[model samples]
Target: MTLLAGTWDGVYRTTGPRFDAAEQVLDCGRVLRVRQFDAFDGVFAATKSGLYHSTDDGDSWTDLDVPREEVYSVVGSPDGDRLYAGTHPAHLYVSESGEEREDDSRSWRELESFQDLPSREEWYTPRHRNEAHVRSLGAHLDVPERVIAGVEVGGVHVSDDRGETWEERKDGVHDDVHHVLVRGPDHYVASCGGGLYRTRDAGESWTRLDDSLDQTYFREAFAHDGVLYAAAARSSPGTWRGERGADAALFESVDDGDSFDVVEYPGHPEEVVLSWTVGDDTIVAGTNDGGVILRDGGEWVEGGRVEAGVAALCAL
Candidate 1:
């Protein structure tokens, strides 16, 4: 499924050039984030217009009840007991039915304490509005008690008690977090506007891995079997209004983001690669220029374009 970012075409599930509507109706707005939790057998999408839920994979989706008008990130607990939604202006809302379901039966409760994190007054976006937004949310597979929220221009906020309390994580490090991928209790990667960072001590310290690449603007990243894949551009998306578009470079780190080398593809994304999905033996990348490239058998292949820009892609 492709979460269209450039227009209100909403989300679509595609098989090569053929595609089908995945949302309830038209003009569902641009989807900023899409997450799938196997524990719940569900998929959630945070869009500019509203939030959505899908139970039977990507076949259908319905708008879920949310208080905010713009949501940036959505993630579920490891046990599927609770669902978390992060929205614009950096607000966090949670719902818990103690059981996972397909509909909006769970009661959502806002966690106002999230705004109390450190240096919140310093959070400001340079290109757009001054206020920050929660762009990425993550949870450890083994350690269910620990969760994290990556707020753009606001640094990282971690909760050890499942979002009951929060603490800011940043020291001698850059913020503007774009995405966070938590693998285990101690291993995680933060794809930030500054560069790619990885923490082995659970956010205690982050080591910048892009000092050599010189491509610091990182948006999307994923790690599997100790191999890390990331999308890097010269700058952020908000500043990409030039006629030249963007210069996105794909990189792979064999040592868990300690170092990276460029990877070539068929339709090398001249724009930013903002979405990534890993299949059984394939890895797919979606670019800001509405390009979808797949890597299988060590060769890159152009799948197709969504025409509305691909922000998020997941195997359903």
Candidate 2:
């Protein structure tokens, strides 16, 4: 098995139960997401530099030239005909042609209607000098035309027409969204700085899932094999540098978010698990402190270490 770690410095790859000797494969900066979609070929990386595609198992990468240099999120249409790239300024772009096209022939058109959201002017974050970003994008095969977007400091929004027009869904959820995990056409889990939220009617409403837990600042949520996993810090990243470090905890839900049970891992309280992927029969988690952990024999154990903090992960 091969594991790809997207970090602040670049992208690294390792084929082992340990990542101590992981090698850098791509130099794209601040990789926010490394994912693979059944509708699309190869692996996609969303980075501060741009969007990249790797076909030969992370051996080489090709820039998709998304126009915007800082791509925070990328997703493919359910039909695999279109590719979406969300940028730092909260702009959305779509490529009708897949990334397999040549660089000179590939084109991406801005989804201008995205700026027409009624709350567009309010999508600013003080951390980014009043600039916000589209931190998460999600699409489900059950709803081919529906596209869900979670914006940092902005809110959650849905576009039924596939990025052409949008409806505000963040009314009941916190605006400091980090990731949106889609389980079905109407089911989604939003990880935000304020709380973790769940929606059943396609984001028309949301319920907080972490009211009983101490950790509130969630970065991402993942669901696999009927199990839900979420890791969160006590507060925002600003408080992650103190003596307690991130003070983070990992939560698991087997009953689909109705309740959660805190699970212990190798790096508890200090190193937050920032990314997750599945390799073979093992569940893999990467941490902000460069720790690689695996779930073996139904328990979390230390697997290895990478050179830099892993922001995203993909297993092939």
Candidate with maximal lDDT: 2
Question: What is the alpha-carbon lDDT of model 1 when measured against the actual structure?
Answer: 0.74
Error of 1 at 77 (Å): 0.6
lDDT of 1 by residue, 169-275 (tens): 76645778889888778777888888888887778888888888857899878876668888787887765656655666888878777777798875454667788
The candidate scoring highest on TM-score is: 2
Error of 1 at 270 (Å): 1.8
Local distance difference test, each candidate? 0.74, 0.91
Task: Look at candidate 2 and tell me the lDDT of residue 182.
Answer: 94
Q: How accurate locally is residue 263 in candidate 1, as Cα lDDT from 0 to 100? A: 84
Location of the lowest summed lDDT over 10 successive residues in candidate 2: 97-106
Candidate 2: where is the Cα deviation over 4 Å? Answer: 98-101
Position 315, candidate 1: lDDT: 66
User: Which lDDT tens digits does candidate 2 get at residues 195-312?
Assistant: 9999999999999999999999999998889999999999987888878899999999998898999999998989998899887868899999889999888789998988789899
